[model samples]
Target: MFSKIDLKSDRFVVVFINDILIYSLDEYEHAEHLRIMLQTLRDNKCEFWLREVGFLGHIVLTNGIQVDPSKIFAVVN
Candidate 1:
């Protein structure tokens, strides 16, 4: 399990890592929560492949979880 980033802004939360940008949006109160989540991931040193990121509205799924899906790659099996 990973700790979550907490964001206090309604705007989207974007983190620039390895030249790629990971973005996520949430309700105003959720802003701080997003920040905390990001921080937790950083603390744990989780390896994230930006190219495989996904998005769903305000949700961002990077590793199998429900995410934006924009940077996620489709697996051909």
Candidate 2:
């Protein structure tokens, strides 16, 4: 499904089932990358929940991806 999108840049994009994580080193490229991703999803007739989406129990933010400490604890213990 992701093959349809051109992701050959320095940015990172990871897709899993209904979740997608788009990252870039800077803001301008990140916006462009996000636009491409959203367009692709719309073209494919896929619906996404913005508030519910996360990658491997981690949240993607401008600073970086953050994992829930509880989830890490569970894995460790």
Candidate 3:
């Protein structure tokens, strides 16, 4: 399923292990990406938690992706 998303996302989605990262340059584009991504997941009947999705030391949230602060702290110290 992750691979499917990666393949269909037109460079807007990435999957690493069990996590996914979807991104775009602006709010509207981001929404469209999210809509497409979520539709794919739902079509596949995937068990998903929007807030719990992330990858490569970042978290996907309602607003956008954010770097995990713990990772930042670990690198800074």
**All models, RMSD in angstroms:** 10.4, 4.5, 4.8
Top-down TM-score ranking: 3, 2, 1
48 in model 3: Cα distance from truth in Å? 12
On TM-score, the leading prediction is: 3
Per-model TM-score on C-alpha atoms: 0.22, 0.52, 0.54
Clashes of each: 30, 0, 0
Estimate every model's Cα lDDT from 0 to 1: 0.41, 0.61, 0.69
The residue pairs found clashing in candidate 2 are: none
Ten-residue segment with the worst summed lDDT in candidate 1? 1-10
- lDDT, candidate 3, at 34: 78
TM-score result, candidate 3: 0.54
Model 2, residue 66: displacement in angstroms? Answer: 4.1
- Mark the regions of model 2 whose C-alpha exceeds 4 Å error after superposition: 1-11, 43-53, 64-66, 70-77
Candidate 3 local Cα displacement, residue 21, angstroms: 0.7
